[model samples]
Target: MEKIAIIGSGNVAWHLCKGLQNEHIEISGVYSKTFANSQAFAREFGLEVYQDLEMLNKAEVDLVLVAVNDDQTARLIEQIAAHHKVAYTSGSVNLKDIDHPQVGVFYPLQSFTKGKKVNLFEVPFFIEAKNMELGEQLFDLAWKLSRKVEYADSNTRSELHLAAVFANNFTNHMYSLSKELLENSKGKFEHLLPLIFNAVDKLKNSAPEDIQTGPARRNDEQIIAQHLDKLEGDKKEIYKIISSSIQKKYHEKL
Candidate 1:
């Protein structure tokens, strides 16, 4: 097991540390700008905590995982470049932005929350590196943490991130809006839980196009109009746009 240091103590850092710890990897220490966060994470993982970047210079670690926010990733990489091999957990950042030759991406394509246990071994990891040798090393590190690992170039990773935003983030936004609408109607939002689960369940074995069912799919202008009439304010406009887009997609299929 290789010794590892993590540069951030946020959700990604927490989950990564937990996964690595479970695999009996050597977590040398964790660093955070705030002592509180670093202490908390270190206590959880039973590793040392470094509060200062300079202190990390003395820590014995093979690789540093920069799990900071996307904007801070590049700067953090630069700070750690002189000390150890570094990798970031960002889905959108390109490795070229960092100066380290051993720099790579160890992006886990899942939303992480502290205290909420996620099975990291089941999550997909997208790895990228500056060279093949570094890429293989990063892949091995990722394989230690996950069973599903893929080597994707920056461009492909960027596209995957965009698709993920649509599939996960935007869809979650839609769910929030639906819940809000249901609450406004004096109905329990939980009523939609089964439908949401079933919709996702269908995707396991069915293509979205083949499983899609809506007024737009049937070209039922009457039902569409009724739905639009039920919606109010900006929601009505959103419904119109989404219905039109869905109709267009299904029409193209026809």
Candidate 2:
């Protein structure tokens, strides 16, 4: 059984620990800067908590997984000695830029939220390692948790992360705006659920451009004006910008 130690107590660390616990891996310990968070995580997972990471440094573990913020990743990586095989779970951060021999990326390309259960097998793992052997090992480990595991270099990973922000973060923000728009109005956000689902289902079998149907895409200036009149401030600006972009995009094909 492979032993591993985690270096964080956030959402990623919790999910990583929980997922690995079901496998043949043994979680040796967990360390965090905050004692309350670290203690709480250790208690939940039945693992030892490390206040000073030197104890975990000396411990015999096959790998040390760092699931900290991008800002904290370099600090933690520098603290971990060369003797340990270290892997970080950051999507945008480049592993090549970091000065380390036994370091790699174990990025999972999916949004993680506290209390929300994520299907690990459905989530894709984008992996990159410092060397061939380490890459292979990281890939193997990722494959254990996710059926969809692929090799991605730092640059590719960063680009993918940027795309993910557009696809997930920006899209979710649009949903939030929709929900806000619905508040104190004639309908609730629930009214859009079926429409949203249909749009998503259509995307499975059709390209977005092919199925693009909206006042913006069709250049329906009347409806567009009505929508713009309903919106205010940043929302109105966002609508105009997107509508203009959509009209321009469709016009280019003609």
Candidate 3:
């Protein structure tokens, strides 16, 4: 796309704008319900600010990229699809749910935090469009930011999103839990960083199941009982559920 307009000024929007501009693509402007947000975002990137949705609809641009919350994505698409070719950055929002002619998905499959720069080239970009022409355009747009681009339908995108929750969200929660336990026991979470890095490093080449170690992986009942004795409430239940799952996976009696 030669010129693009952006909706929402959140983390995803911020990163996309940065990536697009790095490739010398012109951003027509940005729009947000809260004008101040768009103003600030535009100021930071030297872009024009669209004060209202009407102004955005009238802008001259090749595409409108919507990068907002999943729930709000469809509503915005419904409003703007007639005015411009639109794409949203949500994996869970189904494309069929929106009855639009020129709309698509441009989901970047990676966690984003404001001010934290990540290697966009390494992140997977999942594309979904109503037709092959639009699909190719979205793929070309994504390829400007990342080498990993693939077309995925709503069902496959939803499945990938679910897997992301387990791989990133749930794993981060486990780290938070580890920090809590460490602090309660007068230990530092940093002490476990090396171990965490080591485990992640192994995943580059080794199968997780094949390389698994620890009391649960070994079916060491005595150590498992000791760990359970130290945990309480939801933590204890979580431990039990996961340990039981691991044992079952290994064909070991619980």
Per-residue C-alpha lDDT of model 2 across residues 109-220, encoded as one tens digit per residue: 8888866899999989988988888889989998889999999889999999899999999999999999999889999999999999999899899998899999998889
> How do the residues 116-204 of candidate 1 rate in per-residue lDDT, one tens digit apiece?
98988899999887767767888998899889999988878888888999999989989988987887576788988999999999999
Model 3 per-residue lDDT tens digits across residues 1-254: 99999999999999999999999999989998888999899999999999888888888999999999999999888888485899999989999998789999999999999889989999999999998888999999999999999999999999999999999999999999888888867679999999999999999999989898888888999999999999998889989999998888886544
Question: Against the true structure, what is each candidate's TM-score?
Answer: 0.93, 0.96, 0.96
Q: List candidate 2 segments past 4 Å from native.
A: none
Report the Cα RMSD per candidate: 1.8, 1.3, 1.5
lDDT of each: 0.86, 0.90, 0.92
TM-score of candidate 1 on Cα atoms, chains taken together: 0.93
Cα error, residue 71 of model 2, in Å, equals 2.2
Instruction: State candidate 3's TM-score.
Output: 0.96
Over 4 Å off, model 1:
252-254
Order of the predicted models by lDDT, top scorer first: 3, 2, 1
Model 3, which residues run further than 4 Å from truth?
252-254
Judged by lDDT, which candidate is best? 3
Show pairs that collide, candidate 3.
none
As for candidate 2, its clashing pairs are none
